[model samples]
Target chain A: MTSAEATAHYFKKAARIMDVGERIETLLAAPLREVKVQVSIELDNGEIRTFDGYRVQHDNSRGPMKGGLRYHPEVDSDEVLSLASLMTWKTAVVNLPFGGAKGGIRVDPIGLSSKELERLTRKFVDQIQDIIGPTRDIPAPDVNTNPQVMAWIMDQYSKYHGHSPAVVTGKPIDLYGSRGREAATGRGLLYIAREIARDVGLPVKGTRFAVQGFGNVGSHAARLVHEDGGIIVAVSDVNGGVKNPKGLDVPALFDHARKTGSVKGFGGGVPCGSEELLTCDCDVLIPAALGSVLTRSVAAEVRAKIILEGANAPCTPEADEVFEKKGVLVVPDILANAGGVTVSYFEWVQNLQHVTWDEDRVNTELEKLMREAYERVANISRTRKLPLRTSAYVLAIGRVGKATVLRGI
Target chain B: MLDQLMKLPMCKGLSQGEATELASIARESQAKKGTVLFAQGAHGDSILVVLEGQIEVSMSGQTLAQVGEGSVLGEMSLLGEGGKRTATATVLSDARLLEIDAARFQELLKTSHLAALKVVANLAQVMSKRLLAMNEKLIEGNKGKKEELADFQKILSNWSF
Candidate 1:
C-alpha cells in the first residue's frame, strides 16, 4: 500500500477502537487544503528546470499547522499528505499547541549547486508564501534539509512580514535557530527507550542495541545510549552495515564514518548487510532509516525485544501485527520521533519572544516533555490493555477528536 | 578606550600606533539609561562606537537590533550619501560611546591609506551582509506578491478567451 493508504489504515484502526462516528472519521481523514505549485529555476549551466512542489495542510482545529519541508526525489502529494496527517497525531501525542502540515519539492538536491538550491528555495517560498506564516503554517527541516535551509526560509519569509523569525524553525543559531535541535530526535528516542527499558526490568548498562540507520537520529541515539552503558552491537547506513558483538566503539565509529563517509570499513566491526543489521540479536532495535522496512516477512525474523521507531512510518501495519503476535513492544513513530518537532516548537517560542535559550534549557525541557508524554502513553497502555502504539494513538486521536467536536466541525 | 576601539571589526588590522591615532580623533561621551543618542531620519554627522553598555536600534518604537561593547553604530548613515539616520539609537544602560565626526574620519583615511583601506573593506563586508539578508527578505516579499498576481492572470486567462 502507499504511505497515505498505510496512514489511513492505522487511522481506521484507531478510530474503530475509539468508536468514532463515520462522519467524524471522514472529516478527520480528509485534508484541509492541498496546494501544488510549479517551482522553476535557472541552473548555473543556463538551463531552466521545473519541479512539482506540494504543501498539504492536513488539520488545524487545534492550532496553527506545523511541519517540515523536505527536498527529495520521492516527495509527492501522497507522501506529503500522509506526513501531514502524521504531524497532526504527533503534535497531539506530545500535547503541543499546534496542528499539522507538510510540504516538499520533488527534486534531488544532490545535483544542484548551492546557488541553484537557494534560488529554488526562494522560488518555492514565493509560491506558498501566502499560505504560510508564524501563526498560519510554520515549516521546519526534514529529509535532505537542514538549518541552512531553514535559515533561507526564515530570511525569505521575514522580508514579507517584517522580521518574523517564528515563520520557520530549525534555523541556524545565528539566525534565531534553537539550541539542541540538531540532536532532538535521537535524544528523544533515547529518553523514551530509557523509560521502556526501566519498565521492562532491563537496565541500560548492559542492554544490546542494533540501530538500522546511522543518520542524525541513529548516531545521536547510539552515542547517548553508549554513554549510558548500552552496547550498540550493530549499525547501518545507506552505504552498508557494520557489526561487533562486543559492542563497537561508538566514538571511533562516528569518526570513521565521518572521514570515510560510511560505517562499512570500521576496524572495530565486521562488515554486514543492512538486512542482517536489522534482524541481529539484540535487546533493542531502532529503525531510524526509511519507512516500510519492517514488513511482515522481516518482522517475523526479528530478534529484538523492543522496537523504537525513529523514522516516520518505519513499520507497516502487517509488521506491527507480527510484532504483536511475537509479544515484542513497538514504540510508535508519533511518540518516538516527536522530539524534533517538540524542539522546533521551543525554537518557534524563542523566536516569537525575541529571545534565545541556552542548550541546557532546551535539552532539559525536551526530556521533561518526552518523559511526560511517555508516562501518559504508558498509563493508557496499562489501563486499557492496549499496545503502546494504540495507546499513543488513543491519546492523540482523543485530543484531536475532542477539539474537532468542540469546534463544531 | 583604544583597546576597545581596536576590537571593533571596522577598526581591526590596524597597527597599535594607527589605532592610537584613530582613538585620538574620537571623543568619548557618557549617556545615561533611557538616553536617545539619535533619532530616526536625523541628520547624520558622526558614527558612534560603543565602549561599554548596550544600545538598542529601533524604528517606530520596535527594537530591531541590540548592540553591545565593541559594536559600531550609525555607520550606515556615515556610509550612505544622503547622510540620514535609518534607525534611532537609544541607550539601554549607562553607556560610554566614542563618536567620530566625518571630518575626523576623513583625516584618519588621509593619514594612513592602510587603515583607511581596512576600514572601508570592513564596512563593505558589513554592508554586504546586511544587504544579503535584506535581499533574501525582499525577494520573498516581492516574489510572493508577483506569484499571486500571476495566479490571478492565469485565472483571468481562462475566462477571457
Candidate 2:
C-alpha cells in the first residue's frame, strides 16, 4: 500500500479499538486546510520552470499545524495529506502543542541549480506565507529538503512579515535553529531503545543491533548505540550493507561513510545485501530507511525480537500482522521517529521566543518528553493488552478527539 | 561460568573452546569493601568484569557512576593506548572480579579467536561511546541567558518595511 493507504489502515484499526463513531472518525481524519499553488521560478539559464506545490493542514484542534516540506518528483496531495495527518497524530503522541501540516513541491530538487532552488523556495513561501506563522502552520525539512532549504523559507517569509523566524523550522543552527535538531531523531531512537532495554531485561550496552538505512537517523542511532556499548553488526545505506558478526567497527564505518558517502565498501566488514542485512539475526532491528520495506515476505524472514522504526511508515499492514503474530514488538514510526518533529517544535519555540537552546539542553528536554510519552503509551499497552502500534495510535487519536471536542469542533 | 560468559555481550554465543580460551586469560580476584581495584593514571591494562557486588568508578574526585554485576570496566584503557587507567575504581561492597589479561587477549586476538574478537569489538565500542560523550561535552554550551532573550513580538511588530 502507499503511505496514505497504510496510514489510513492504521488509523482505522485504532479508531475501531476506540469505538468512536464514523462521524468523529471522519471529522478527525479530514484536513483543516488544503493549499495548492503554482510556483513559477526562473532558472539560471533564463528558463521559466513551473512546479505544483501543495500544503495540507490536517488538523488544528490542539494548536497550529506542523509538518515538513519535501521536494521530490512524486509530491502529490495524497502523500502530503497522509504525512500531514501523521504530523497531527505525531504531535499529539509527543504531546507537542501543535497539530499537523505538510507541504511539498513536485520537483526533483537534484536537477535544480542553487539559484533556481532558491527562487522556487522563495516563490513557494510567497504563495503560502499568509497561512503559516508561529501559531498558524510551521514547515520543516523533509525528504530532499535540508536546513539550507529551511533557511530559505525563513528568509523568504521574513521578507513578507518582518523577521518572523518561527514561520518555519529546521533552519541552520547559526540561523536561529535549535542545536540538537540535527541528531534529534536518532537520539530519540536511542532513548526509546534504552527504555525498551530497561523493560525487556536486555542491557543496551552489549545487545546486538542491525540498522537499516545509514542516514541521519540510522547513523546517529548506530553511533549512540555503539557508544552505549551496543554491538552493531550490520549497517546498510542505499548502496548496500556491510556486516561483521563480531561487531562492525562503527567509528571506522562512520569515517568510511564520511569519506566515501556510503557504508557499503567500508573494508571493516564483509559486503552484505540489503535483504541479508534486514533478515540478519539481531536483538534490535532498526528500519530507518525506506517505507514499505518490511512486507509480508521480509517481515516473515525478520529474525529480530524488536523492530524500532526510524523511518516513516516502514511497515505495511501485512508485515505488521506477521510481527503481531510472531510477537515482535514493532515501535511505530510516529513514536519512534517523532524526535525530528519534536526538535522542530523546539526550534520554532526558540525562534518565537528569540532565545536559543544548547544541544545538551535540547537533548535533555527531548529525553524527558520521549520517556514520558513512552510511559504513557506503555501503560496503555500494558493495561489494555494492546500492541504498541495500536496503543500509540489510540493515544494520539484519543488526544486529538478530546481536543476537538473541547474546541467545540 | 561459561554460560554466564556466553550471556555477556562481550562473549555472546561463543564456541565452547573460544569461551574456554577467553576464560583462561582471566585472573579472578576477591576483595573486601574499600578495596581499590585500580587507581587513576596507574598502569592498569586488564579488563574488569564485575561478577559480584558493586564498585564505584570516579574521576577527579567526583564519582562518575556505580557499576554492579555484569558491568565491565577498565576495558577502555585496556583497548586504549598507553594502557593507563583513566578512572579510579573502588569496591563499594565485597566483590569478585575477573581481570582479563591484555597480553593474553592480544595473543588470542592475534590468533583470530572469535570470542576474543567479540570482546575487542565491544571494548572499542564502549570506549568510542565514552569518547562521543566527551565530545558532546566539549561542544555543549550553557543555557540561553535571560539578558539575551529578545522581545520577539515587540521587536517584530514595531518593524516596518
Query: What would the DockQ be for model 2?
Result: 0.00
Please write out the lDDT profile of model 1 over residues B1-161, one tens digit for every residue.
Answer: 87888888888788998787776777999999999999998988888999899999999889899999888887754453537788999999999999987666776566665666687778888889999999999999999756643543343233221
Model 2 lDDT at residue B60: 85
Real contacts recovered, all predictions: 0.00, 0.00
- The DockQ of each candidate is 0.00, 0.00
At residue B143, what lDDT does model 1 achieve?
A: 96
Model 2, stretches more than 4 Å misplaced?
B1-161
Q: Pull out the clashing pairs in model 1.
A: A159-B137
TM-score of chain A of each: 0.98, 0.99
